[model samples]
Target: MSGPDRVAGRTALVTGAGNGLGRAIAHALSAAGARVILVGRTLGKLEAVAAELGGDSRVAACDTSQPAEVDELRAVLSDEDVSILVNNAGIAGPVRELVDVEPAEWDEVFAVNVRGVYLMCRAFLPAMIARGGGDVINVASVSGKRPLARRTPYTASKMAVLGLTITLAHEVGEHGVLVNCLSPGPVAGPRMARNFRLEAERTGVTSAEAERAFVSRAALPRMVTEEEVGAAAVAMLRMSGLTGADIDLSAGMIGR
Candidate 1:
């Protein structure tokens, strides 16, 4: 796809670009003419994604949850004018009842999903503001706004992202920055497959049955694809006037 030209010359830094939705978003941004920077905890994975983009695309290894690592990452790319920041690095915490969740596990979830966003924005937003404008797209989830049994950590972290996106928009808009979030539903991928298997084991049902129940709850009766989520991110980037908004790319299941 020739993609949109709005971001053609911009540089976009996408955390978690090593795989899944993050990888998809990196590709979409590259195709839209942005010089993509693939950032993640795994060096090899990030390098692989950068190779795929095969241009001015670069790679940086950083565990966003770690403040030191994020600071170093900012230093590493200090020369690059990153006009877009995609905060997509995240992990699925253990799926279990709230009572069964460990405090450390809950902290781990918030560290990556919530604190990671805070650290990235803190590191990059000043530069963006100095340059006079930028775009930030935080990858949240539909589970944040809806009830998802046995996923308190993940859901709560995502809900925090929603709140962060809107309020951050309020704080940064005066500096010409646009901050928004994309809340995707069950995206068809290995991650969702693992979730299905876990749910099946917990509920004493087959994985297929678990998957069916999930998709069946959506108005479209299907899971959204990673590519769709990636495309949505690019679309959000192209919307120049949009800010403080949560775009639900949940296959019509958002309100259900």
Candidate 2:
């Protein structure tokens, strides 16, 4: 049970598995013996990750924002046994003031972050319930718990995810499905790098300076890693009795 044998018989569907936290979680689950289905908009990136993992790893190119694409993805997975579902695909757009943000951009953010999660759950949860039990992990953010200035779209979408997680957990608890959310703090991923660059442009500061300022807001004064978030996801999947819980993997940032 040292390697893939631990999760050998399990199947996992990870959205946004092309990079960042989703990629890390896919790798982790695969290492633990799960057959990972990597879903993302980029086939090349997903295939690259699948090749690296080997052994039952699959790539499904999907723009989660599109309902038809999501339905097709569900049809593609119709015959598979998926034990774990990680709703990790998301976007952190420009940090614009509420009034200054374009309406379309705001809608797009919710389309991916909120609607995508809902569609995935709708597509997979029935099978999971029929099979007796499964785990669903939503990758929310600290902003979901507290309001952050200049990121109305991202924050609002994450909040919606938190609500969805809670309701789904309650709905499926008796059926043996576990639904929970992990609110990660400022993790040093490509998204964070992009956010930093945007901040630099906004304030006329260097990217390095913006990153430093961003990290300073954290109580730990350091960014969390993808492996750390993956570990939390693994824990959630392994916990049979937990549901409707918001596990904060923020390195003690929320209360402070």
Best by lDDT: 1
Quote model 1's TM-score.
Answer: 0.97
**What residue runs in model 2 are displaced by over 4 Å at the alpha carbon?**
1-8
In candidate 1, stretches whose alpha carbon ends up further than 4 angstroms from where it belongs are: 1-4
Give the TM-scores of the predictions, in the order they appear. Answer: 0.97, 0.93
lDDT of 2 by residue, 1-256 (tens): 1232325578899999999999999988887678899999999999999998998788899998888998899899888888789999998865889999999999999999999999999889999899888889999999877867799999999999999999989999888888999899788777778888888998999999998887777678788899999878887776667789999887666874
Expressed as tens digits, the lDDT of each residue in 118-217 for candidate 1 is 9999999999899889999999999999899999999999999999999999999999999999999889999999999998988899999999998998
- Alpha carbon lDDT of residue 43, candidate 1? 92
